[model samples]
Target chain A: MTAPAAVLDSPLRELSYAEAIRDALAIALAEDERVVLMGEDIGVYGGAFQVSGDLVHRFGEERVIDTPISELGGAGMAVGAALTGLRPIYEFQFSDFATLAMEQIVNQAAKLRFMLGGAVSVPLVMRFPAGSGTGAAAQHSQSLEAWFGHVPGLKVVQAATPYDAKGLLLAALDDPDPVMLFEHKLLYKTKGPVPEGRYTVPIGKAEVCRTGSNVTIVATAIMVHRALEAAEVLAQEGIDAEVIDLRTVRPMDRETVVASVAKTSRLVVAYEGVRTLGIGAEVSASIVESEAFDYLDAPIVRLGGAEAPIPYNPELEKAAVPQVADILSAVRGVVRGTR
Target chain B: MSISSETERCGAQAPAPGRKGSGGSARPASRRAGKTSAGNEPFAVRHYSPEVLREALRKMLLIRRFEEGAEDSYMRGLIHGTMHLSIGQEASAVGACLELTDQDKITSTHRGHGHCIAKGADVGRMFAEFFGKESGYCRGRGGSMHIADVDKGNLGANGIVGGGIPIAVGAALSAKRLKTGTVVTSFFGDGAVNEGSFHESLNMAAIWKLPVIFICENNHYGMSTSVERSTAVRQVSDRAAAYSMPGVTVDGNDLSAVAEACHGAIERARAGEGPSLIESVTYRWRGHSKSDRNRYRSKDEIDAWIARDPIRRFAGLLSEHGILSEEGFARMETEVAEQIAAAIAFAKESPDPDTAALTRDVYTTQTESVG
Candidate 1:
């Protein structure tokens, strides 16, 4: 299936991924009085990645709150605020720092509504600046979206393009449940055409970035762009590789992957997290567990991060995660039925 | 030493009950006096009307009886999971919530049955939750530790020791931002005072000038660990000074004293003066939960706390003040007992949740349904 073309009501403007996110925050704050932004260094600091640039100035300090260096307390505060009447968007300085606030995110925010027998819904959104590329070492650089996706009652999404970054964020605000948005750091400066007005991209749906028939390449976050690059290389070699960008991780778009796999007769699941128990495993299991299992022409290939922390050295950092070359080779192997 | 002996020492130092018609006033009295003495009137007796005092006594009795009934059911093997009984610490819960209305929010700890009752939760629904029935407060999804009545401003009780502290601060933030005029009270045990969340929440609430009251129910122990062993400060309230908030330590078993301390803190919060910490020094007669074997304390200590039961002390004080007659006290006890019995019967007759609808509340959208 092809990606849905958004209706062009307004002129398209070029926006970096970070600018698009800031635009969404500004829009949310302007439209709803309940929307509040909370994080460390978010106010005046323009956020760690400048994704919330100039929002504090435009919305005031009360709305773009700068919380203390208390991740557990700050996250729980967002949960509490969301539980009440406020719609809070909490940003973790770095996705790796989410380890400090796992209790509130997992135990409280993820299970509060279900535990309370649906008495209340947590309309909370958490922004995580994730993935490795810059010299952030092991602690600062990590793709932890799969960790959040494993939990129920949480909507986890990764917006590869600037268009989806703003659209998915707006959609997450409309959601009643807690949504964890993982914005890749490398994609922050990447510019794309985005709508000028408010728009929403449906969550829990995967978009077909490229169409082919030899093999289906399922990718997430930064890997989506890498798989698209690999698809171009594969097409030159007479390998028609279909690329599916999985937008949401928790409520995964399994139908698109399954239908694509059934047509291509091969699968290559690419993700930035570790290979074992990562989203790739879920995608692979979803296809094998479905009727698409009968259409497999060869064993499914998984292109994932190496079983080690993201190193400080540039070369090791690049080696730690799957690159376009790795996706190209993995897709080639799956299409050619080679071990 | 032992927390019970420390609690006993504090109990011995408490002032004698005030005489009737000595200092009773309809207007709200200043709590600057801190501790009531023989010359000064007891805070509740001096501040509240006879009707409010009578209702306070009734709620105190109801808390004690409800825990007793719950214990009875647990012993009879009717209830499944273990429960944290607030049997002896009823005064702290009832007194702290005495001035709260439906608009005010409260976050409770593991031993939160008293808080739930004090916050006006239905006893039948609470019991039904314990029985894992469909008609319970959480519809049987949240059992004893997570019971909540959002409409009554009772955020659900937390299983983690210090989990609810930050949540209460957030609620207060909401109240201040939305101009709801609602004050939030966070209730936790002595153990929670040492948690990082406690200190962080206190600091945030102070800086934000949020309308929140931190009520530390110093039951002397967080499970098996005593306050003296766990906490560095002399009293839990002393830590509030770090956050630039007024801190007070009161005899938690004394209903009037606990009520008086909380009244001041609640007033301070409502006025947007920022958060205040009140450490209610009390003891639990029962072991921490159903699994406790009383290895931490002695039988003598338990008996001493039982003798200083909050319900008995409050009833005796009410009787001395001519607010409740001995006959009226007995009638109240009988009535509370009947209510508990009826609640249990309702729970027994209530239907269990259907297995097919197990994942009904996982998400509001119901996009992907699977248990």
Candidate 2:
């Protein structure tokens, strides 16, 4: 079950990121009786973002429960259920609402096992439909993966493509500790090839989506696609840019980023979070702290979200976060030794 | 009277008149009189067997001694950090857990030593945890505030107020989903009632009809602020009506009173009747913590509560019923004292945890090589 042998022989089919996540949920529900799907409006209403479409009907309301609009209570219940015997997969309607449940996420779920001297493990998975792009305004569109990444007992992961989304969601179920999967709302409709059966992508592992040598562009979630597009444009101008998608943020894939930085000699971190104290800062710190610092030919550049909150206006929301143009300009600046 | 009517009667009299005296003993004498009589042999004395009653008294004594021993150790500088002592709230802890078996689960508060002991945790390991020894419940990772014996069905004692409320509801949810036949009792104070987690958790439990008992050990103050100053509702249990669950308030100092209320709630929960709110109205004799100066309340109020000490009252009740003699009670106290002394010695002798294994239990599986 650990290896993707079924994935190898099974016919590959294109699935939207949301559909892929739903597939993983369906597979988990069918395979394990202990797996329960819980969230607000996830039952007959098909979830807030329609990620869990018709799961409650197929799995029964008892298994795929529609909890009251109580994030803190619901999340804490998932943690408690995980502690005892159940493997609960909880979904937050939007990542911004996580602030309401931070006590359970940060204090209880993250620290329960450690606080109890490893006597118990919380095999809890929380899916957050994160990032801005939808005109959901300041409350619902902010990218807060960095907040969970800062926690010690949590495993934070971001899936850029449909394949990784399903694979990572499956891997999170296999994990014993609490794993937080940050699924970007913008990428939910994006299509990619996903396997038919159960398969897991290792947490804390980065994938080099596009390989080059002039500069390394480290990105996560939606920014990974932007960085890849920027790399394609950079290749046309004879500048070879490497794009590395940092899958996990807490137990960060520092070795992969460090090695990529060592080979490229210049680094550009592109993320959708705020500029200060964001994922970019952590990636940059890992590079400088490692032996890869000696290979640097230019100062590192970070293409992150603006310091302001995500606005209701589409243009302002697009300007608030990094786009393909921002990643391209940042990578060009790093490669040309201008940053 | 029926248990429901009795609960309603007590619930209506909450914030018991003359609770705050003007520099003198304003204790409510009528509420504490004739609790144990030949005809009305309190709920626990009548319902429980003589052996169970004896055990309940023993556990109540153990809780009291454990807190006293912990306080003594802290005073001697043997235990580091601060502790919220539950010295005077022993009956609420023990009575509420009187019917619970080893398989039953409980989530405790910061002042949780009583709950931990009542739920059958070894005192030796609890002491070792206070000493920060490797042989402790949490292997020195969690001290007094976070002590837990998971295998014995104690989830943990939460440092944050109302933090364990939702977790307890979740545990009850697991019990219902997995058909584990486990009922979870979540212990929090009066102050935690105002927390959003409390309201949210109660509503969830009530809606799902989960087998959980929400035990509020209403010891007046959340640190220094009294319930009257902090809470809008007169009684903590009164808030239960909002969530559509049966709410009851009992004299927490009376072992049978608390046990009776909790027994009804626990039985209701196990029968798939959903959750019930039980407010065990008691008081803490000592200051909230070691740093407290007792400035918030008068010494007379503290003295008045001490006069109605749960352990003494329970012991006297047992003697009055011919379940245990006065000499037997003295022997029980001596036995608990010796046990506590032995526990302290074991804790002092326990080995310190190696610094190298500091981060060993942070994650069950080593996902990352980096700290």
Candidate 3:
């Protein structure tokens, strides 16, 4: 597969990664009356990160509501709106702050439809800016995608590029169940070629960013970029390692994973969340429990953050999360096998 | 601590049942007249007409009976989940809910049967929920604590102590944004007033002027801890002033008083005056939950609050006004009993949810395949 030949032919503009999100929001709101952006400080304050810059001014306050610092209240309100025939795109100021609203997300909004016996659908999207940066410390910096993926009813997506951000967001709005979109705080300034017109990427499919045969490196969120960098380093050593972005974590792209395992016979799962019960666990367990187990010549390797709480100190925080160097070493170890 | 203070005659000295001086040893109507005349004049109360009063009485009795029946089932080992009975505090739920329009919404507490009946949930479906049948409001997945019907404006009963407060405020926020003209009433016990969500929600509602009524049913105890011990301020309503909103305390045992207080707050909220808090002073006749032994209180105290029983008091007023005779009371009881029995029968006959449906409503995916 030669990568679908860049379906978007428009000249790529030099927009910040955050501008791409705003552009995506502008397009969605301009195209559909049902789409609305809601969050704390997103309106008059242009979002805490300014991702929704000028959206309230552009779409008016009715469409872009600046909510109080009540995550649970705002999330529940979004759930109510979504239930009442509206597509509500909710923003948590920071992903770490999402813990305050867990009751609404995990208990009510996530389970309402299923509890109602298929009679209702919560067509809602909750976007949380995740990962460590800007010295936000323990309460703000967390790669918590695994916590949401652990849930049964929610679809969790982490888009690495600007194109995936726009496409994944649109797809999330189109999804009937609640979709959790984890946007990395560090990736907001990075930009890429995003389609100008409306386009959607299927939610539960994984994109193999690079193809190789020596080893399979699966990563998510910021770790996807790190894995890509590691893939280049491994290739320089004549070790062709395949890199797969497990974009959607809940209904995981197991077929792509199994296929990669069959080709390489070595697997390395990387994530930024804690090591235990993280996406790595799910990916590793899936391979062992499936037909892919027979094709694996070596044991599957898993790499993730430490189990301790995210530290405020910059050095400890860096040590807690996986880096490009970590990915390179993990990939090499998997390729070299038990030695 | 003399009982002869001018405020004492106005029912202000009516200690919670089973508390100190809670026995009905106080002098009769003679003392009540003197107390009520001096201190009660300032607190405006709306009186219901004889016919209207009788109907409200009927509703309260229905809630009491329904809960008692649920307790019976729980004791017999028929119900799978824990049951929280609103036995003593029926008037607060029934009285306040009666003031709401059909389109008005409410978020309920764990002890929610009273709110469900007052908000017009189908008794059969409520019974079905207790029975764990597929025909229940939540299709058996929500059991008791999560029974919800969006159509009926009953958002749902929550299991968390102050969980429903934020949700109800959210619904009110939606109503304000959508111009739905629907005001939400969030019912929680006095204990929930101490929760951070309670303050957060009230502050938000006040700032936005959202159409919501925060109804705190001060049933004296929050699962065995008295409100006085848990809170420094005497009444939960006083906290409303912190948000710059009006606060009122009403006699929860009086159905007319509760209805009027809630009615005023709802009207003000709909008029865009923002949210208000109404602290209804009531008692929970039963323990916090079905399994609680209620060793914290005395028998005499329970007997004291029983003297101010909402249903009986309202019924007495109705009879005194010639609105209901002995025959009418008998007829109402018979009708209530028959209705409850029919609901039980309907729930029993209703089939259990298919085992395959266990994974059905978990998500909105088109894949009919099971997880």
Task: Give the C-alpha interface root-mean-square deviation per candidate.
Answer: 1.4, 1.0, 2.6
Compose the digit string of candidate 1's lDDT tens values, residues A1-339: 112345365678999999999988998999999999999999999999998888889999999999999998999999999998999999999999999988889988998898888999999999999999999999999999999998998999999999999999999999999999999999999999988768888889899999999999999988889998888888899999899999999799888999999999999999998888898899999989999999999999888888999999999999999999898878777777665
- lDDT per residue for candidate 2 within B269-350, as digits (tens), equals 8999899888887899888888999999998888877766777777766776788876777788789889999999999999
TM-score per model over all chains = 0.95, 0.95, 0.90
DockQ of each: 0.70, 0.82, 0.46
Judge candidate 2 at residue B5 and give its lDDT. 16
Where does candidate 3 chain B have its weakest 10-residue lDDT segment?
Answer: B1-10
- TM-score attained by model 2: 0.95
In terms of DockQ, the best-performing candidate is 2
Ranking by DockQ: 2, 1, 3
TM-score of 3: 0.90
Error of 1 at B99 (Å): 0.7
lDDT of 1 by residue, B302-361 (tens): 886787777777776677667888678778778988999999999999999999998888
Per-residue alpha-carbon lDDT of candidate 3 for residues B59-91, written as tens digits (9 for 90 to 100)? 877888788788887778768869788887777
The digit string of per-residue lDDT tens for model 2 on A1-339 reads 245676768988999999999999999999999999999999999998899999988999999999989999999999989988999999999988899999999999999888888889999999999999989899998889999989989999999999999999999999999999999999999999988988988898899998898999999999999888888889999999989999889799899999998999999898998989999899999989999999999998888889999999889889999999888788777777665
Total residue pair clashes for candidate 3: 5
